[model samples]
Target: MELAQRVQSLTPSSTLAITAKAKALKAEGHDVIGLGAGEPDFNTPNHIIEAAKRSMDEGLTKYTPSGGIPALKSAIIDKMQKDQNLTYNQDQVIVTTGAKHALFTLFQVLLNKKDEVIVPAPYWVSYPEQIKLAEGNPIVVQTKEEQQFKLTPEQLEQSITERTKAVIINSPSNPTGMMYSKEELQAIGEICLKHDILIVSDEIYEKLIYTEEKHISIAQLSDSLFNQTIIINGVSKSHSMTGWRIGYALGQAKIIKAMTNLASHSTSNPTSISQYGALAAYNGSDQDIEEMRSAFSDRLEKLYSWIVDIPGIHCEKPKGAFYLFPNVKQAAALCGYDQVDDWVTALLDEEKVALVPGSGFGSPENVRLSYATSLDQLEEAANRIKHFIEKHKG
Candidate 1:
């Protein structure tokens, strides 16, 4: 049997692969503790679920417009204006299956063969793969943990070439859980503007910030930048609606139209009931979000302190998102392991703990642990991780 070259060239999602391995072990009666899954353990909020139920009851189960239903599009536009202080018309917004789909559509519509995309190191696992699938080259800019794994303006400027078509900025970053400040964003935005480069801002974790720092969209900095930026966001992380598969993008009408056309040929439209659920998520009270954010913040603090106490394990306090990326190279060395991937695999095999190696995210010395589970599970996982490190160290 043979597969298409394009399909054969693609790599599977490492995060999902780790989760599947954990599930397979559990099915065989192993007591696996999985901290690799990205989605929150919390159920979708009641109002959002109720809206989906009502939509199904009202027989609104058919296909919607390719982009999205009119009501959901309007709701998304309003939410952007109110929450992010960015305004867009209905035609400028297109809801997709999720932020992942929005990003794929954006890349498919905008990228060409030999085009270059600036992807900061320690990036989300999907960014580089998605670029490759579009036949675009991924130009990686490395960042250090001491710098909180964020790309500086100088690094951004240095990476741009004549072939550079776009740069991806994932605030509340996927693996690092770090965010860029408004000033940082402005600096990078200026560089992109000067080079006439497009900005792909992934702000899916916009509402997940845990510090005094606010998440600022690069598009909001200037009108010119706004025209050049495509903002991708969704209800998956914010409203615990990952299964709902509803997300959106806001950008210039021309670009949005292109993405919608691409989506029309592919997914056609997002799920009808899920679109209604996302509409309610945007129009509904944000009180539920505030509560979830607070709980995650609390859990993050506890987890950070616990991991820091483990000798030779280094982790920066993440300001947003539900992940902690710790550099465990020293522990790996003590365990006679040569790579973080091997250490992670051994830990899962020996201690029934599952985590993602940093190698998958363009780093080779760290591991990503998601704290989206309950506090009790987090505590137990941390203890098991500590014991594993200590046992290996000795």
Candidate 2:
């Protein structure tokens, strides 16, 4: 059997790959401590679960509009207005299977063969692969650990060429947990505007921020940029509804329409019951989200301290999200591994601690550890990782 060239060229998500390997080990009675998966360990809030139950009991388990149900769309609009101070009509929003789907849909609609997208180094594992699957070239811009792993305006400007179509900005980024300030976003927005390039702002972790720094929507900076920016958000990270598979994109009417059309031909609408659950999520009190964020922040701080104590490992204090991307080149060298990927594989095999290698995200000497688990699990994982390094040291 033969597959299409596009499908054959694509790579599977490394994050999920690591997770599956960890799960398989656990099934064989190994005590695997997985820090590779991105989703939180918490159960979905009770109110959201009740909303889904009510939808099922009311027989609302049917198909919705391809672009999403009107009620959910309206709720999303309201939430965006209140949270990001950005206004959008129902026509400008389209809910999909998840933020991943929303991003793929946007890329499918907007990208042409050979068009370019600028992705910062240590990006989410899916961004480059998704862009490649869309037949778009991914131009990577390297950002240093000293810079907090954030792309500067100059970096963004330098990466733009005649074939550039869009630039992806992931705040509270996947592997790094780095976020951009309003001023930083404004500067990059100006550069995109100068080149007439689109901004794909992935803000799925907007509600997961720590520190006193606030998340800023690039679309809210200016009317001009608003028309050129597509905001991707979901209930998975914020509401602990990963299994619900509810996410939405907000952008210009034409872009939204294109994405909706693509979705219509593909998955049609997201699950109707899940849409209702998402509606409840947006309309419900944000107090639940605040509590979760506070808990994650506490766990993240504890994990950060533990990681820095490990010899040959250096980590930055992330201001948002629940993951830490630590530069472990020294650790890999001490362990006599030539690559971070090899080190990660050995750690999972020898220590039963699962983590994603940075090579999958455009960096070859780092590793990403997600602190989405309980504080106790995080502490144990850190200790195991430390022991693994010390035991293998040259």
- Enumerate residue pairs that collide in model 1: none
Model 1 CA deviation exceeding 4 Å by range: none
Give the Å error, residue 389, model 2. Answer: 1.6
Q: Write model 2 residue lDDT over 326-364, tens digit each, in one string.
A: 999999999998888999999999999999988888888
- Residue-level lDDT of model 1, residues 280-350, one tens digit each, is 99889999999999999999999999888887789988999999999999988888888889999999999
Count backbone overlaps in model 2: 0
Clashing pairs for model 2 are: none
TM-score, model 1 to reference: 0.98
Worst window of 10 by summed lDDT in candidate 2 = 7-16
- Candidate 1 C-alpha error for residue 232, in Å: 0.3
